[model samples]
Target: MSLATLWALGSVGDRLRVAYRLLSKDLDMQIETTAVIRNVQKGTASGDLTTHGLEFDQLDPAQQMAMKAFVFDRQDDALEWSHGAR
Candidate 1:
């Protein structure tokens, strides 16, 4: 199982559908999924946006693949950036 957490700068309902874009090669990739607000708290900021911990509740097969690709891509970037190795 994978964990999904989203910190919104605003209020989100208990359950909602969200669509977001990721860095896709040669194309704009947008993934949609349904999530539920599990917890809300303040982060390192002073603004109207309250951090909300979101848990992904539903995702189709295609969506899962896209998300996995996105996560892996991001992880690779982090590793390369941190280790100064491209």
Candidate 2:
């Protein structure tokens, strides 16, 4: 299936799963990718993923949604990597 289709149809977890699967060819790639995702998830949960050390909760709702989309897209990009892209 195409990524756009998956992105349109899948939930966040599903997208992450597909991303990880695509990265599975390289152990380091998988580890690093998942680590970043985990950190973002942690920040989302605890409100700490800010450049100014402000809690994520302190951000306006639009900023919060932007952050989530940024993190999610980063994970999605993992699915597009090639050996040279690594």
Which TM-score value belongs to model 1?
Answer: 0.65
lDDT of each: 0.65, 0.33
| Candidate 1 CA-lDDT value | 0.65
Give lDDT: candidate 1, residue 85.
61
TM-score of 2: 0.30
Residue by residue across 15-86, what tens digits does model 1's lDDT show?
767777766553357767777767667556555445567778877787777778877877777897899665
**Residue pairs in steric clash, candidate 1?**
9-49
Which candidate ranks first by TM-score, i.e. highest? 1
The runs of at least 3 residues in candidate 1 whose Cα sits more than 4 Å from the true structure, single-residue gaps closed, are 1-13, 43-45, 84-86
For model 2, residues 1-86, the per-residue Cα lDDT tens digits are 22222113323333233332212222223211121111122223344432211122144455445555656666666756643364
Spell out the clash pairs found in candidate 2: 47-56
Worst 10 residues of 1 by lDDT: 1-10
